[model samples]
Target: MAFWRSTSLFSSSTPSTTTINDNTINQETIERLCDRLQLATRIEDRRDALRDLKGYSKKCKLEVGTKSMILLADILQGDRTDLDLIQLALETLSNIMTYEVDNNDEQPNLPQDITIQFTELFIKNKEHVHAALDLIEETDFNIRRTSIKFLTILLTNCTKTLQDIILESGPMGVSKLVDLLQDEREVIRNDALLLLQILTRSNANIQKIVAFENGFERLFEILISEGGSDGGVIVEDCLSVLLNLLKNNPSNQSYFRESSFIRRLVDCFALNSIGEKHWLKQKETNINLFLQVIRILVSPTNSNQNIVACQRSISQCGKKKIES
Candidate 1:
């Protein structure tokens, strides 16, 4: 959580010199920790090994660029049997990443060093080389949930480079990332949507690719199923991601104009107003996102059919209004 605040200096034209120091790394201790982490038979033993390493790195304030961080990421890929192992791996990776780029500013793009490090490690692990694809398919819900955090750390901080990784993994990985939007785990779904928001807003390349894969259609499905439910923080995020995907993204405009999103937009208003006024405040925010989406989807130069459709949709949102 703290890592997202620390903006990666690499995102700018003039990247700052990495603050990660490497000279004092006690190579023997790191090797010993890695060996024990891989070989320990007992769950506590394994977790302790990871803990020691976490402390080791933190004390040294290692940059995520080190092979030690890469090793921790490797621990994440296996068909892990121990929940503790998986959790330790997850936390260890989280700690290393935060040490590398922990900022309080809440910036989005990850530094180039951190991005390249994960990419290289993910490439080497090969167990889940396809990334979110295999990880999302894990039978363990906890594992799946942890994957959400790990993947978020990777993509949110680095836009284009990470997008290139998914694109190279082909449509399956990309589709898996989208499928995450509908995950039964609310946090997973929210994280997936957040990642998609980054892709659509900052990475135009992924936006067009997502359009081809029926991403907008799938997102609309999320709206229809989860709209106006006060389940979690996902409602506004879901709506916001769809808005970003369709905003100025001309390729998706056709689908949005013809989409049940129009109807859904109208329904969100219904859900927010008198019919479901109990959720008025939260649902109203969703309605605002919907309205902005409508404005973007219907351009004067694009199609009057869509414009007229949007006009009808806006009117439908007010249909629930009562007369004195």
Candidate 2:
């Protein structure tokens, strides 16, 4: 989420800014904010502290590192009625959890030690992960969306640990994520695709659960809805998730074949034009991912019948894309 602020140079009655916006925030300020977050009796004070912390986190990664994760998680797990507070905490946690280490000279990237510490602290307690999953059940799209972003960061930093927790949360955890695929908001839907793709990359259990949750079917439905190859990066993102599911897992591969998704897969290859200019990088990438899915299904490891069936599906395809 992009942060936007409006400033009035002539106004004198504005609220005092706790976090210095220009320079890297100091550890003293972070500790003060965490103290407020931990001890604040009223929801308004907690929100004020979290708002300042969220602002500080965007610029000073190490100062804010892992200091308030426990406090934030407490708010998430304990507070149900304050949607604004939950959203602020999630956003602040996301900023603190950001793992990308930029080499920019203006602001030094977080050291390796801090990054590992952040990941370990969050995963050490299973409730933190559970609290994150619970926030998604909230009806507010902003909270749900921020929760997804926080989970994405967590999953990226600690893939193995987070994957285990998510799987242990039962089918409900992964199911809620799959439901995001059908979100009426495109941004939410796209973020869910990326999250599921990362979540299912190496975990066969998650891949199976997602596949059972109609992962393949919904992905194909989204593909058609986005205009197949005529769509943008979303088309490639959808194929990437499909490829992960079908890649090495025999069960998912068999599911793809049995579900008659092979017909749908081949239909995506029918582009408006095959000429060089017509094939934008994104379309070519989508088509390339499509071939990968097909290859996985028809690999020698799969049954000979499955290979023949997939081959037949492709051979029978015409120029026109299949209607969903």
Best by lDDT: 2
lDDT of 2 at 250: 86
The C-alpha lDDT values of all candidates are 0.61, 0.78
TM-scores of all candidate predictions against the true structure: 0.68, 0.84
**Local distance difference test, candidate 1:** 0.61
RMSD of each: 7.6, 8.1
Candidate 1 stretches greater than 4 Å from native = 1-31, 38-47, 55-59, 63-67, 77-86, 99-129, 208-232, 271-284, 300-324
Worst 10 residues of 2 by lDDT: 1-10
Q: Give the per-residue lDDT of model 2 (tens digit) for 1-324.
A: 111125322122443465334332366788899998889899799889989988877566655654677787788888878999989888877777664456342135334455556767877889889998988877788998899988998888889899999988899889999999988888899999889889988788899999999998899999998878767888988988888887778888877777778778766766546555656777778778877877787889888877887777666664234443
Q: Look at candidate 1 and tell me the lDDT of residue 319.
A: 66
